[model samples]
Target: MRTPAARTRAGSAALAATAALLLGLAAAPAAVAGADHRQDATTLDGLAHRSGRYFGSAVDNPELADTDYANLLGSEFGQTTPGNGMKWYATEPRRGVFDFTAGDEIVNYARSKGLTVRGHTLLWHSQLPDWLSSGTWSADELRSILKNHITQVVKHYRGKVFAWDVANEIMNEDGTYRDNIFYKTIGPSYIADALRWARAADPKAKLYLNDYNVEGTGAKSDAYYALIQRLKADGVPVDGFGMQAHLALQYGFPYQMRQNIQRFADLGVDVAVTELDIRMILPADATRTAQQADWYGQVTSACLAVRRCVGITLWGYSDRHSWIPAAFEGQGAALPWDEELRRKPAYDAIGAALTAAAVRRTG
Candidate 1:
């Protein structure tokens, strides 16, 4: 019934309405894309920040000399652990004489990069100075020495470091205590005493007992759980547990890693992946690399699933300076970044896992 001009006008109006409707639908997704774009732009630390956690890496003093390595580390991670600078040998080289030069270098570097530090250790079986390791002392003498060492170190780095691995690698794989120099001389009570002294030195610093081979629910981890529970019952200032998570491809992925992290979280203390690295035999293949990526994602997911699994710190971010090549003969390529500072698949896997966690939290 309409004239030709009227028909054309109605057709134009309908087209305009359809286009506007289409634009409305497109704008809805565009808003979501904006969020996704923001997420993509965020750094690993930023993604972790969304979930109230941190992502960290370990850096040794010598490695910081590598400009590229240092720059990337300072930019990417939110936290750092001094690989060796904070150890007993580096911190206190002589009897009753302390030198914090090495640890200070790392702490200062971390500050420049806006990264908080986790004091690598106050005590460890290995890397002890000759004065402490080679000497023979009665229980009382050693106790005095231990208390002084812990108090001094913790006091020195108290405000700078958020946490301290008060004692490292104290238990054997069989769930029994390792007969290290401390155990042999100061007796088992040294563990509790060391924690107590560290607490007195810095009541605010989180205290943790760290060990490898405890990523899974095995005898080693069981020993730590029981020890931490007893320590808590007795009102020790035990604040967290650190699982070194030094995984090897040949050994297979840790058994029930998520469940293991959750169990430690239920104990009313934070859990952390203190030193994470996955190594394989020399000459990595596609299959191994893929599997390694899978393992990295799994570990990240496991940590993210638990509220108390505080953060993850790679032993070293890049294979360029990884300790595996020197320590583990015939096994290397253990880190997320390759020797050339190129990202390996593991890096992407970790990013994806962190991104997923952030998305879940925002959603």
Candidate 2:
């Protein structure tokens, strides 16, 4: 295996060049736009049109200048989300100071392009501003703040966003509640409260409990199952489960994961493979790359096998733009697209899975 530093340096060089090329062409005259681009012009668009679903990507504000990716994505997926922009930190950096301009720009852009919009999250532990996490606030105060934020944000986007990640990453690996400030202060009931408030703010939009590592059975998944059962029994407003299918080449594909997904659907909720990517160490040889492809195929097959799995969004369009490389040392080329914006084996694998035996409907 290549060292993480070596891989980062190599991957960084490749990604930098790719980013530069994309940025440069974005500034070029519109007439020449279609002449030199490398992305498969028809691939994503064709898949989305045929599948009746949407693909998504995260965007940095700077990348917004290069509308090529967005244009390409919109053509195919016809749906967009902040990816990270709508998170608690970006939306509300200060206690009461809400800033939706950045996120709103992305949402408005998607809408203008005739695309459906999904809000990335309403509640999450990551990317939360320091003040919210560190401030000395009473339990009641925290609950009040949380309720207000959810109500305000959901109401603001009412009728526009097709779905919202109402409560994100709330459960632990053992499926027990992750102890966050919200959970600590407001207790386990905060999840239900957030969902109820979101529904009250926008009754029409679908609300989801989003998390990573819940795609397969284990401690974390078991916890989610119990939580969902309790919430359903209590008549909480959770309508969907956002499975962040962040996979790795080495880990065995969670084969029985569909059974868990079916259980959720049985409770009358939808399941979406949200923010998916399969990461592998850099200098990927042919065999390692093929393993990555197989991992993607297995995940997509699971989603297709489970009936309630309605949406599958690659974490990003290409490895060049993937966050995993930076976030996870040595983990590069995590997505279906290669450095030059070309489709990899993983792309073909997913496409095949989607077209696989008619998806088995559950619940």
Candidate 3:
């Protein structure tokens, strides 16, 4: 999971210098163009924002000004979400105290721009208010409180949000359940209960179970598969699965990651490449950066090839504002857009993959 923090004064200075270099590169036409650039750019841009899209991102940092967001909205990208807006802590910081100001602003902004809004998360272990963690309430009281929170928040944004990650990162990486407050108080049944409450609040919204490390063969993925199968067998209202593709360059990307996605899609649920990003060290090496670009191309192509994979979103817009630098020590440059907001090779590679998909569709 990615965490955010203020950069150290020294780190900030280094980032500023890097940003200047990126800005200069972004302004250079030669850096922006190459063989088949125009055609690929057009196709990539079109497919990127097309309906049933291949690309998306979260709005977390203010560095992405309104104009920046406007430009992205005007492109082929048609979906937008507050990466952290719908989280439990961000929405309800105090007991029975709801704050929808930030989330409302994001939703209204995206809707006004004619973009689809994905409500990031209603339940998760991370980002929960401190109050919720303290053992103060009985099981019944906690259940009621949980229900009310879901009902109020989901009702508030009822019709606007296209989908909601109803439960997030509930299972551990070792195929067991994580011992969170919800699990301890409400029991394992809390997962289904939360989803049921959310659906009752807003029947129209698509509900999803979201998590990380479920992109490849592992205990976590296996656990998720079994859970989904059981839920479907019992007729649970789970509508989708959000595969949080937070990849690291050192891991060499997950082997047969797309096959894992296809397996989830086979369970008859829509699949989304949620929270996708690739991270690497600072003063990025050219060879490794190229490898990152190739990885992006491969990931995009895989999603395009699978019809049920409806959306792909970067955790952040650019390395400048990426959560990587602050969250993961010694790893920073991790997204398709560079620090200065210039399109990186990975950006072009993603565009090329989308362009190729669109060509195949037309051909």
Please tell me which predicted candidate would have the highest TM-score against the true structure. Answer: 1
Off by over 4 Å in 3: 1-45, 49-51, 61-76
| lDDT of candidate 3 over 96-207, digit per residue (tens) | 9999977887787666655568887888878889898764888898888899999999999999988998999999878899998888887988888888999999999999
Q: Please, what are the lDDT tens digits per residue for candidate 2 over residues 222-267?
A: 7777788889899998899888888776565666667877888887
Predicted structure 2, TM vs. truth: 0.84
Q: Where does candidate 1 stray beyond 4 Å?
A: 1-41
RMSD of 1: 13.9
User: Model-by-model lDDT, in order?
Assistant: 0.83, 0.70, 0.73
Candidate 2 clash total? 4
Q: What is the lDDT of residue 229 in candidate 1?
A: 92
Clashing pairs for model 2 are 173-220, 174-219, 175-220, 175-223
